[model samples]
Target: MTATAHETVRDAGRALGIPDPVTEAFVRLLRPCVYPCLYEQLPEESRKHAGPAARAGGSAHLPVDVVVPAYVPHLVTVDCAAIPTDVLDIDFPADGHVAILAEITDQDAGFAIHVPAGTETVERRPRETEPDALKPCASFPL
Candidate 1:
């Protein structure tokens, strides 16, 4: 039996240590905008680079930045990052238009997703409060 493009993506996500929920969300969100064939052709090396960062968050619901190499046709080497739904403030099953945030230059267009620290509900609370939470530790006398 042949694996569908979606399955390939899921497998890739698994190999990268991305949580199942985030991977499923990515597959569902990008299904309409991205071609199926592209998912099948996702490079192995790029997946390696993205895996560590994706898993660094350690939460299934946290938004992930999936950077696909040559995402746009004829734009080889210019990767595009897929923005997760949470970052865009979109709800599931809504069928809303997805946006790809890109930096376009004369030579190339590079897309990226920036999820600031402490933005997600799970990460909002600090694991351990410092003596001076508001100020940097370095600012105080040793």
Candidate 2:
């Protein structure tokens, strides 16, 4: 079964034009990082779905924020110092998007961060719900 899953992943990676070695390396990295992050939320028996599933659960759990830094040369800052140190920063490369899953309680409403895209900016909307605009695809399930 393990071998079959590995083959499935490898085949999918190949179909997407990723080399076998790179795909293997990514699988190695995600295996260690992804589970531990989810585990931090709760014990195994009481565990809900991680990543997007948790985000879809709405007010019952934390909201997942996807931060996509522009490709042009500039800085896109995300400061979470006001929040607890444990949930401070989400590490993502400048060229990639990072998913930040945070648990909001009744005592605290939400935190603010200023995300700038070059010289232009957009108005802020409700943070909890996904926008009504057209989506490229349905949520990417892990």
Candidate 3:
């Protein structure tokens, strides 16, 4: 059974008992790999550039880990109202273990890069800059 991008990530995550924060990172990673399909499903104006290369083998490609870029704003945002504060408020021992908090803040603080499964890090890069999108593909802004 093939999993849609959203389903693939969700299933793998749930089965392994991945936490909510990690799951959000997975979704961000998935957007780049699957956004082209999403665009095709949208109207033409909504659909702009696709991606750098056609995905190999037509099977799914997903990124496992995302890193927090330096000095960037908003890696992810938490909707405090949505989740049960009782659970999200889970506490850590206060013996100077603040770095973990900082790391979480950093990863959730700015944009992220997602390298697809089976691909090397060097292959992933920022798409070209465009007025319509966050970063456009390399074509001199059409």
Candidate 4:
């Protein structure tokens, strides 16, 4: 029997040592956006530039941090409640991408989506503070 995409993602999360609750939440939140059929079912208002706003709100409340690790993206810290809802009006293309939301330290909380340029998988660890270093613990890929 073939493992469904959702199962595969769940397995990946387990293999990466992500906690069960965080993995489950990530899968739940990602289901609508990752699958085309599910994506199509979303309200029209949600399909337009909702990624950033959703990311901001979700990251602030949840213990998980969403990120695309292959691109080595930098974390963007912001106060979710302080973000204006008008951010949804910014026209940008966000398609065919899925992020992994992992439970990380409070200092590591942030958003980090990037256009993937390589195949390196993101590994989460305690972040070390350095003036010009890339912090890898902020995010990972699905």
Candidate 5:
């Protein structure tokens, strides 16, 4: 079976004698490679701007499978809350693009849907910018 990104990197770390923290940092930096779908699925309004960073209250952490076309697939966790107003005003796009976390069979493959199965439609809410708003929203059991 194909290894998870963490396992793949960890194996490389062991072979190269890289520290755990360094390997982890590398993984984090490379994590966004899977999110190209985010840009593609962005509301037309948000596509023209740079993607926003994860921030408190405005971001929801969901285990998503982002598949940028023609790239290696990713099964990384991402925060979908609090898109910057300057970037995009919406958080999770109501557009059906997120994939079902449980039904995701190919962790290393791209998902086709915008929203996956088993997710409730979240109510539209205003952004939360408080520093303390950085708590975990809903976490997928997967």
Candidate 6:
């Protein structure tokens, strides 16, 4: 029910280990700052099949945030810049991933983040194959 592959990726060079304390520390700082800001895109952006709520709300209402906490770090925007609730979000660089989670709803699903395209990735997780291939998994419905 939690993010297995996601967590596994943290120790890419290693077989199975918790992400380093430094990485965890960064995660602590990063997750809360990003979730609220970026979660709104889940429904529309996900290529996976959307359920009834998405059909009713159109592509704009994917509710994937509820499950993110157990698996991924949640970062709410830290800036005091008065970001509109709609604009609050987290962005993931390549070799890393981010999720903007929605509050728990009847349905739960959200979008994953990485550099849009052709942008430099400053920070990335340790990986065996690629350093910055930040990919996200979907919560397939039961």
Return the top candidate by TM-score.
Answer: 2
For candidate 6, which ten residues in a row score worst on lDDT? 53-62
TM-score leaderboard ranking: 2, 5, 1, 4, 3, 6
Tens digits of per-residue lDDT for model 4, 48-126:
7444322211221212343333223333323233234343434333432223333345655434333232424343333
Measured by C-alpha RMSD in angstroms, how accurate is candidate 6? 19.4
Return the lDDT, model 6, position 66. 26
**Shift in Å, residue 103, candidate 1:** 16
> Per-residue CA lDDT of candidate 2, range 9-81, in tens?
8899999999999989876654312222233556666555433221111111112353422211111122222
Q: Candidate 2's C-alpha lDDT?
A: 0.36
Residues 27-54, candidate 5: write the lDDT tens digits. Answer: 7655223233444556798667645432
Q: What digit string (tens of lDDT, one per residue) describes model 1 on residues 1-142?
A: 1238679899999999999999989877663332222322457765443421112111122143443332221111111233233434333322222223322457565443334334342222122433322211111100
Every model's Cα RMSD, please? 19.0, 14.8, 18.2, 16.6, 16.4, 19.4
**Stretches of candidate 2 exceeding 4 Å from the true structure:** 32-102, 105-142
Clashes of each: 0, 0, 8, 0, 16, 22
Candidate 4: segments with Cα more than 4 A from true spot: 1-3, 32-142
What tens digits encode model 3's per-residue C-alpha lDDT throughout 5-103? 667877788889998679868676542311223234566775464332222211112233444332332222122222223422243222211111112
User: What are the lDDT scores of the predictions, listed in order?
Assistant: 0.36, 0.36, 0.34, 0.41, 0.41, 0.32
Which whole-number lDDT from 0 to 100 does residue 108 have in model 6? 50
Ranked by TM-score, the better of candidates 4 and 5 is 5
Q: What would the TM-scores of all predictions be? A: 0.23, 0.24, 0.21, 0.22, 0.23, 0.18
Error of 2 at 23 (Å): 0.5
Consecutive 10-residue window with the lowest summed lDDT within model 2 = 53-62
**Residue 39's C-alpha lDDT in candidate 2?**
39
> RMSD (Cα, Å) of candidate 5?
16.4
